[model samples]
Target: MELKEKLNILADSAKYDASCSSSGSMRKGEIGSAHISGICHSFSADGRCISLLKILLTNVCIFDCKYCLNRRSNNIKRAMFTPEEICTITLNFYKRNYIEGLFLSSGIIKSPDYTMEQIIKTVELLRYKYHFGGYIHAKAIPGANMYLLKKLGSLVDRMSANVELPTEDGLKLLAPDKSSDKVSKIMQYVKNSQNKNFVPAGQSTQMIIGASRETDLDIMQKAEDMYQNYKLKRVFYSAYIPVNQDKCLPSLITPPLKRENRLYETDWLLRYYGFKVSDLLDDDNPNLNILVDPKASWALKHLDEFPKEINKASYQDLLRVPGIGVKSAKRIIKSRQYFRLEFKDLKRMGVVLKRSKYFITCNGKFDLNKEFLKKEFIEANLVLGEKANSSSNIYQLELFHE
Candidate 1:
């Protein structure tokens, strides 16, 4: 088949993999440079939009993952890109300023080792033969040979071995061919490897949300484990999109976009704001509140902790307050050293006072009247604010754009 035809087929097939962000990798060589920015119009840590040419090496698979569109039983057009073809496309796209890097994933071909070898060969061709040194994020085939995984890690900026479902039971029910242990082994390998160059951007994994019967607590606990044990760079949450009919899978018409957003917000809390999974969830409340963001939900429940005096609260205390993000919290700390802060100053410092006002007091003055401090009133207003900003609350990792 022609290269364009192959590209069209493989790229479309690769769309479901959401672990394609390309931040935290920086490499410069003769042909291209991988910046700290991400792919698919994603903003970097420093907030610059970038793009990548995301595609699959091949769509033919040995495993029949029920959630996957390219599962062996599915009737989809199959295409494979030779190592030379991939290098050609990546370099051409880089030279034309169309993309800053490549995000490559593939289905298991003959075996895990064979598929991994093919992917490694393609990356090797790009790095050594063409001197293309852009941000390449490759998927590590779970159960691939250890040597191949290490070799691929050295060549690419980032690598991921997706733990497709949240729990072992979910894996057994929906994707029996895959094992959570294999994915964990890959992460363990990346973590234990002594080589400084092994995946300089570190490793990340993707988990499909709302697929099986796992609660948000189950998913976040799993993510927290990956972060603590594997030292993973990211644990991407892709809301399940019903593509194939199966008795085992949820028969939802639309993806649970709100749940996905709440997960991301909760993830941010865990990573940056020093929140434990236990702090936000319990046996009674296993799932996140879909109405308000995780931080706001927590603030509403723990009203006794508020209204924290803004001027006297420590940096950690400031972060715990609703609507105060990392940047704004830091700003609050640095600015409070200069003068006594008030509500107007917080708004200027980028705090979402609509939510924070219910929980914080600026210099002994309540932003809202004490009568409005009731949990029901606060929850209602927060929910209304969330509905007003509903369009912007949904977060999905964009892998490609026209």
Candidate 2:
């Protein structure tokens, strides 16, 4: 097959994996601006990444995962590229300024080990034969042997092990062949290689939201475990789109966006706002609060903890208040050390007094209606501020991607 034909098939197949980013790999004016933040050239029509030349090594899988579109039973077009072809395509794209790097994933062909080896060869060809220094992200197949991961890690910029589903039971129901424990173990192996300089960009994984029967709490717990255990760079959540029918999964038009937003909110809390998964969710609250963002929901539920003295509040203390974010809280911390802040001083510091005022005290005074009559207190109150905002949170993520 021609190289372009191979590119079309490979790129079409790889779209299923969402673990990607060109962030954190900074160079001092060498490889452009270093994207110290990150660079997503554009988002796709479906709101997915189109920055890198993302594609699969092949769509022909030996294993059959029921929820997947590329499974053996799905009867989709199949194509595979040789190592030289992949390396040549990547070099050509990079030279033409068409892409920053490559993102390669694949269906399980022959066996996990065999699929992984082909992936490793493509990247190795890029780095060695073609001398390509551009970024590369590859899949670390779950049950594939770990030694391959170790060698391939040094050749690629980042690697990911797709979690596929949230829970083991969810995995059993949708992808009976997948083992969550085995998958997590591969993540752990990748993580351990950090000191060896195996994968400096760090590992990431993906979870298909609203698929199967797993609750938000269940999904976030796994995310927390991945971050805490594997030190993963990210855990991407793709709101499941029903491209196929299954008796076991939901047949919704789109995965719940609000729930996805809620999870994003909850995820922000876990990574930046000093929250335990147990804090935001419990037996009573099986799913995240659909009405309020998780952070706002938690603050309201623990009302007694609020109305804190912003003038004297520590950095950690300010972050706990409903509306205070890392940036605003830092301003409060720095500004207060110099002067006793009044309500107006907070506004000057760019702190949203409307939301912050209720959760905080300026000179020992709280400004909030005892009735607090906004219909959805979190939105009308928190977002729309009493007003609106997490800088080390979601906005950070959007900026990180942009």
Candidate 3:
């Protein structure tokens, strides 16, 4: 087939993989440069937007993953790109400024090892033959040979081996061909590799939420384990978009985008805000509150800790407050050393006083009237604020038309 036809087929097939963000790789090359923060329409750590040409090497798979669009049983346009073609397209796109790098993945073309070899050959051509230095994020095929994994890691800036489902039961029920043990081994290999240059951006993985019956707590617990044990840089949550019909899968017409967003928010809290899964969930409440954010929900439940005096609270304490972020909390720490922080100072430092005022105090005085302190009132306001800030009008409109 022609290159354009192959690109169209494979690119469309690869859209379901959401673990393509690139970061922590910096190299100066003869033709292109990989910035520290780059992904498809994703911002880097320093806040620069970067784009990549995300595509699959081939859509022909040996495994029949029930949630995947390109399963072996599915009737779809199949295509494969030779190593030379991949190099040609990448260089041409880079030269034209159409993309900063490439995010490449593939299905089981022949075997895991064979697929890894093909991916390695394509990236080797770009790295050695063409001297393209742009950011490349590749998927690490589970059960591939260890040597091939190491070689691919050395060549790419970031790598991901998707865990697909949140739990082992979910894996067996929906995707029996995939082994959670193999995925864990891949993550462990990346973490334990002595070579500092192997996957300089570290490794990340994608998990499909809403595909199985796992609760939000189950997912967050799995993510926590990956972060603590594998030292993973990220665990991307892709809400399950049903592409195939199966008796085992949920028969939802729409993807659970809100649950995915809530998971992401909870993930940020676990990573940056020093929150434990136990702090936000329990046996009684195993899922995140869809109405308010995880942080706000947690704060609402623990109202006895509220009205915290901003001047006296620790940095960690400031972080627990509803509206203060890491940057704002640090500012509070630095600014309070010189003078007492009032509501105005908190606002200037980027605190969302609309939410914080209900839970915090400035010099032992609440910013708003005491009437706002009622639990019911605070919860209502938080819900309203979340609804106002949500960008769900498009989804709602589509639902209405349907």
**TM per candidate:** 0.93, 0.87, 0.94
lDDT of 3 by residue, 46-150 (tens): 333447788999999999989999999999989999999998998998888878789999999889999999999999999998888988889999999999999
| Higher-scoring candidate on lDDT, 1 or 3 | 3
Decreasing TM-score order of the candidates? 3, 1, 2
Writing each residue's lDDT as its tens digit, candidate 2 over 304-401 gives 77668877777877888766787888888877778888887778777766655667778877666646634355455564431134322433343333
Model 3, clash count?
A: 0
Segments in model 1 whose C-alpha atoms lie over 4 Å from true places: 39-50, 194-196, 391-402
Q: What is the lDDT of residue 278 in candidate 2?
A: 95
Q: What TM-score should be assigned to candidate 1? A: 0.93
Against the true structure, candidate 2 has what lDDT? Answer: 0.75
lDDT of all predictions: 0.86, 0.75, 0.88
Using lDDT as the measure, the top candidate is 3
Ranking the candidates on lDDT from highest down gives: 3, 1, 2
Q: TM-score winner among the candidates?
A: 3
Winner of 1 and 3 under TM-score: 3
Cα RMSD, each candidate = 4.6, 5.4, 3.3
Candidate 1 lDDT: 0.86
